[model samples]
Target: DQQVKQNSPSLSVQEGRISILNCDYTNSMFDYFLWYKKYPAEGPTFLISISSIKDKNEDGRFTVFLNKSAKHLSLHIVPSQPGDSAVYFCAASGLGGGSEKLVFGKGTKLTVNP
Candidate 1:
């Protein structure tokens, strides 16, 4: 059905602490996984991504891990800051010649307390 699922609607963490978000997908054809962070009324910014061929990808404070066997993926933020409070969306797409639009989950709102 092309559905990516993020079970948690929200997460809260203290500043300088680790924040983790989880997501799941049912489609086996999906070959790319992406994470996007969004601020209020602003477009989502690309955070990190992993291809099905790889298990882990990291970018500074952000990290993404993919488990192809379980059709699951997760995003981790190290030393979360007050500015990190925003919505996180997990997305996936299949490899194809034509346009493969990304399918996003409901999104998780992360709050970082100072």
Candidate 2:
């Protein structure tokens, strides 16, 4: 029941355009939300994150917005670049446990066309 869901398996956008990815979760105990970007054959790298207490978090080109009431979250990349083409994973973890085991979605592959 710890499934975090990313409905879209892929997204494509032109360079310098905005890219949006959506995610949902069913577990109410989850208190941390994270997004990770991954290149082929490489480990996923942390992007942006928001705690359950907050509604929005941003990091340069990346932003994450969480709506706990609906159990939904989204990631936005503004002015996407060719370098941003990669798989993005949305993850969540419960607080109070030092265990950093993150439950991840299948991932959405974003291709930024130049």
Please provide TM-scores, in order, for all candidate models, with all chains considered together. Answer: 0.94, 0.94
Clashing pairs in 1: none
RMSD to native, candidate 2: 1.5
How well is each residue in 2-103 modelled by candidate 1, as lDDT tens digits?
Answer: 489999999999999999999999999999989999998999998988888899999999989999999999999998999999999999988842148898
lDDT value, residue 8 of candidate 2 = 95
Q: Can you tell me which runs of candidate 2 are displaced by over 4 Å?
A: 96-99
Query: Model 2: how far is 77 from its true place, Å?
Result: 0.3
What's the lDDT for candidate 2? Answer: 0.92
Q: Per-model C-alpha lDDT, please?
A: 0.92, 0.92
